[model samples]
Target chain A: MTYVVALDVGGTSMKGGLVTRTGEVTVLAGRPTGRENGPEAVVEAVRAYVGEIAGLGRSRYAGPPAGVGLAVPGIVTSATAVYSANIGWRDVPAEAFVPSGVPVRLGHDVRTGGLAESVFGAGRGVADFLFLPIGTGIAGAVVLRGEPYGGARGWGGEIGHAPVWPAGEKCACGQIGCLETYASASALARRFTARSGRTATAKEVVELAVAGDAAAAGVFGEAIEALAIALASYVLLLDPALIVLGGGLSEAGAALLDPLRERLAGRLTFQEPPPLRPAALGTRAGMLGAALLGWQAAGEHDVGADWPIDVLRGGSVS
Target chain B: MTYVVALDVGGTSMKGGLVTRTGEVTVLAGRPTGRENGPEAVVEAVRAYVGEIAGLGRSRYAGPPAGVGLAVPGIVTSATAVYSANIGWRDVPAEAFVPSGVPVRLGHDVRTGGLAESVFGAGRGVADFLFLPIGTGIAGAVVLRGEPYGGARGWGGEIGHAPVWPAGEKCACGQIGCLETYASASALARRFTARSGRTATAKEVVELAVAGDAAAAGVFGEAIEALAIALASYVLLLDPALIVLGGGLSEAGAALLDPLRERLAGRLTFQEPPPLRPAALGTRAGMLGAALLGWQAAGEHDVGADWPIDVLRGGSVS
Candidate 1:
């Protein structure tokens, strides 16, 4: 069976996978992006990881992989990694990340994750929705008409930076009242510590809030309110069919969904709120989406649509 | 030259025109919608107006009009008027508004104006932008990839009702701090009268503000700030290449555009603010867009691209 090498490159680490045409997956141990060593080193590390993954695929499937796909941070097109402030890269071609003679494709990291959700996870069968992953930093994949739309210049879906209070706290992005300032996973932890002078992870904070800790509850409450306001704006502006929540914070599950649903409904007077669902693919979304891009690079544009979700979720790991 | 019957249906008035395939236009005097008479009468009024314009087209060209296109208020599809709270209509088929056997098309009023801007006015050649008309109320036409988007259920582009201040003023829509509560033309007039204890039109309030009246300046300043906040949220979420401002308040010209540009820039910390320009079509955008839709119904989907801007602006009126 022919397979492809897929990589999801993040600010700190890279997850690699090998997938066959029918959705069988073998996930490899992740590697550090080594961005601290400089952009060129990071690029070299990616190439090396891809080469190693391809080597494994060749031994198992008895041939070179069909194609390669990498989901990279920052402004990306299918042909190039335009820019990534975190990775300190500029205009890196997709070819540089794969072996010579192999067709390769690239996608924006968050949008690729969103694409996975759209094709095989929570957003499956839904045409228009927002794929929002509330991680350390918040961004969204505006999936419209069955594809992620990155507006005029590929800087679209910066929903976290959109103001919630308009005149409230200053964000690290220098914008005032940005939703990320109160609602992102990093913000949850930071604000919780700032309020009570006790440090805790975002997950811990959520648990504390659920257990009725007043400081955690206050911080968590603000996050939910800020999220409600931002989501209300999103619903009014885009009127999506669904909102799929992902990333580290969504692990709070019903704790996040139940309150956010009620608050969002309260904010919107005239329209019904779209149902919110948790992301199904978890951290593997970017890598699986990369596999789809890999198949696209291999001229198999329709490959991922029929991939069984059970096989994708039940895949073996090494 | 063959022509089409085009009508723009508003709450209180209907504007009709006969537009030739080669872009020649004859605009007729508008008639009151007379909604006080009820919904059936409104539909009858529209059909009679369409018959009148088709008669004008036949007399002018010695043949039946090619098609009829109407831009109506509320939820609309190309083939049906789904619902209009203002017009109090439900599921009115396109054929009911025009002569039988003459192909007909319908469009949402604000989005139709945006289509005109996209095809022949300010948004010409721009692939993505927001066409916002701040008239009696505020709504937006989200023009993306050269077409207007109505989101999942044709309830999109309600930017006016998107909250600008989460805890601020109570809006008539039962939402808190909607953009319309502070920035709509009606809001300006009402807020000015409320603050100064003197009734004045929105235009007079603008003039007074420009001429150094403290109450007028305060009211206008708040409107601009509210607009800036709403627009900043739009920019962050959509990242459009440009923003086209239309409707009654936009007539303030530099008085509105200049301060708004400055404030919008200030709100954005990273991305460059898109250039804000006035809508080129003014009050006639809806009627002109209906002309394009009329052409589309005639299966001439590409007729508007070559229409001269000067000719559209200088169309004869009776």
Candidate 2:
């Protein structure tokens, strides 16, 4: 069976995968992006990883991979990685990531994960929704009419930076009252440390809050409130059918969803709140979405629609 | 020349017009909507106005009008007025407001105004922007990819109700810190009176603020701040190319736009704020948009693109 090489390039590491036309997935061990060495090193590392994955696909399937897809951070289009402050890359063309003859496509990192959710995860069968991943930083993928919309200049889903308090705490982005300042995973840990004078990861803080630690509870509660305020604005403005919550913090599950649902409902007076669901794909979303992009580059635009969720979730790791 | 009857139904009055296929417009005298009589009475009033305009078109052009288009408030689809709290109507079909077999279309009042702006007014040639009209109440038309978007259930574009402060003040809609509670035209007057123990229209309040009245300046400045906060969130979330301000309050011109531009810029830390422009069609946007809808119902979807701005601005009133 023919397959394609897919890579999800994060700031620290890169996850590579090969997927057949029928949705069989083979996930390879991830590699360091070598971003510490500089932007060119990161680009070379990505090319090496992609070639390695494509070589595996070729040996296994007796053919070169059909196409390559990479999900990269910062502002990106199908043809180029426009900019990424994290990796310090600018205008890196997609061709630089793969073999000369292989067709390749690129997508914005968060939006590619959102696209995977829309096609095969929580947002399946839903046309309009917001796919929000609250990781170290917060951003969203605005899915409209069955596709992710990046806005006029590819900066549309900066919901995390949209002010929740407008006059409250200063954010690292130099803004006041930004949702990310209170609600992102990094914010949770930082605020918890500030309040309790004890450092903890965001997951530990959530557990502490659930265990009834007052300081953790307060910090976590503010995060939820910030999320509610931001989401209330999102619902009023976009009126999406659903809100899919992903990212490391969403591991809190009902601890996050239950309070957020109640607070969001309380915030809105006239309209019903859209249901919020956990992201089904977890960290693999970007890789799977990259596979879809690869298939698109291979001229199989309709390949992923029929992939069973069970098979995708049951992907084998090599 | 064939024409169509176009009507804009407001809570207090109805504006009617006959628009030719080539964009010639003849506006009729306004009439009361008489919504105080009842929803059925209001529906009958619209039917009468539409029939009257069609008759005028028939007499002027020696043929029956081609179609009818009405812009009504609240939840609306092209074929139905699903709900309107202002008009107190529900599930009113488009045919109910027009003569038998004459093609008819309906649109949400605010979004219709935005449609006019998108096709022939301020938003012409822009694919994405926010068309906000701040009158006694506030609402917005989210124009995306050159069409007015009402969101998942037509409950979208309620930016007026989106909380700006999240804890500052109680809104009439029972929400806290609504943008409308501080920045709507009526809100400006009410807050000004509350602060000064004196009465003034929103326009007079703007004049007073410009003339250096401390109370008026404080109240108006708060209004501008509220608008800036709300609009900053809008820019962050959607990243529209432009923002078109309309309705009664926008007549304040530089008094509103100048400080608002500065404040909006201050609120944003990362991205450049989109340019803000006044609504070109003014109060006539709804009627002109209804005319475009009439043409759409008549199957001439491309009718409005070539209409000169001067011609649309200089329509003869009868």
Candidate 3:
């Protein structure tokens, strides 16, 4: 069937699988990223992980995949320049991480996840959507016409650093009042700890909020309000058909969605806010998006011609 | 010698010119928009402007030129539904303003201006640049690879409405602390008047600041500081190669760019500070942009197929 391999390279872990054309992923594997040693070590680790995935694919499918796609965190200049704060790698050329002529495609991890959800998962058929993953930090990927929007120099869907609480908290990025400080899982945990004078993980706070604990409820409600503010601005600017929520906090489900929907409804009047929905594939989305990029890499010289609009629409511009 | 009629619609007036492929404008004239009477009046004004331009072109050019390119202020949804607060327009089908069978290309005014600048003006040869017109309200146009980034819904450059002050004065758009309320020329006048207890136009304020008037300098400094904050966020997000200041505020020349550059330098690192330059053309940018669009409307059918990359690089996804 000539399947492809997809990988998500994170600061602490690498997760990926062999994906078929139908969006099915097999040969799943997880391993430590060991990125603290810097760019060279990170490159070697990614090569080794991709090799292991290739081995699994050959052993199980009895055929080598057409190509490989890899997703990574932080600012991605192109397949040529990968600078990541999470992984501590600066300007690592993407083609250097893979074996020669294996046909590797590189993309921003969140954007790739957004592509996966927009194409094969929850955001299917929606023309515009914001994929916001509220985890240890909050970052977003914007999808338009089923393709992720990478702005000038590939920095469009950067909603996390979009400045949430201008006077609220100081971020490690040296900015004041970033959204991640309020809406991320870490934000939830911090708010709970600040209010209750007791340390608790985000998961614990979620449980307490569900159980109707006043302090936890207050913190959770505050977090939802912050999310609403950020998403409301996004709505006015992008006017997406829907918004997909992902990451660790999204697992709380309706507890997050209902309040968010209410807050968004209160603020908007003229804009057709995208319907709210859950991300379909979970953490595996990055891998799937990378796989899609792989498919593109293998088919780059085909009918599409790698034209920008074709790259954006997978067909033509509207 | 083929030419097309171009109509540049603004909140208060409609300007028209016969534009050639070589970027020449002839027989320019303008009439009051009188849009308060609603869509019908606006359409009539537009029709009259187009008629004059068409007459001028027919009398001068030999071949049957293409259709018209009309630029208007508002959130344009396709060739229909133009939403403008000043003009009091909503869901007004733009094609209704044109003669039947005339290929009319409708575009947001700022985006159209951006197109002109990118192709024929100061931004020429720059792969990426952002155009911020500091008029009564501030808005931006993202130009990449010789085109404007018109988001999925044609609203990519809404930098004015992007939040700058967390607890700032309420905006008519129902948002608080938008960049428009601080950095625009109108904002400078308002802030200076309130601060100095003496009413002054934005230009006068700049003059006073240059003359070392403390009160004027303080208020002008505030406006520059606000621009710095907004541009910092912009640089982090889009990372355009250059930023061109346009419109009335930009007319102040070094008065606007010099301080804003210093403030921005103080804020960002790791990202190269793009050289800030003044927009070469004056208010004529809109008219020139409209003409450019008309010239392209003559050839857009061929270009549409390849427009997405330019769009994405321009902000196709928002």
Predicted model with the maximum DockQ: 1
How many residue pairs clash in each candidate at the backbone level? 0, 0, 7
Error of 1 at A162 (Å): 0.6
Compared with the true structure, what per-residue lDDT tens digits does model 1 show for residues B58-86?
88799999999899998899999999899
- What TM-score number comes out for model 3? 0.87
Q: Write the per-residue lDDT of candidate 2 for residues A40-104, one digit (tens) a residue.
A: 99999999989888888888899999999899998899999999989999999999988898999
Winner on lDDT between 1 and 2 is 1
Lowest lDDT block of 10, candidate 2 chain B = B309-318
Ten consecutive residues with minimal summed lDDT in candidate 3 chain A? A309-318
Among these predictions, the greatest lDDT belongs to: 1
- Model 2 CAPRI rating: high
Per-residue lDDT tens digits for candidate 1, residues A1-318, read 999999999999999999999999998889899999999999999999999999999998999999999999988999999999999999999999989999999998889999989988899999999999999999999999999998888888999999998989999998899999999999999999999999999999999999999999999999999999999999999999999999999999999999999999999976899999999888899999999899989998888777888645545556
Task: For candidate 3, write residues B1-318 as lDDT tens digits.
Answer: 777777778888877766555444563647789877886787777877676667656776864458788888878843764688778778777578776667677778887777666765668778678888888888788775556766666656777776667567776678677777777888888988888899899899999999998988998887887788777766755567889889898988988888898887765644656889887666767776766666566775322222221221111100
Per-prediction TM-score to the true structure, in the order listed:
0.98, 0.98, 0.87
Pairs clashing in candidate 2?
Answer: none
DockQ of each: 0.86, 0.82, 0.31
Clashing residue pairs in candidate 1 are: none
| Model 2 residue B201 CA deviation in Å | 1.1
* True contacts recovered per prediction: 0.81, 0.75, 0.28
lDDT per residue as tens, model 2, B140-177? 99998888988888989999999998989999999999
For the predicted complex of model 2, DockQ is: 0.82
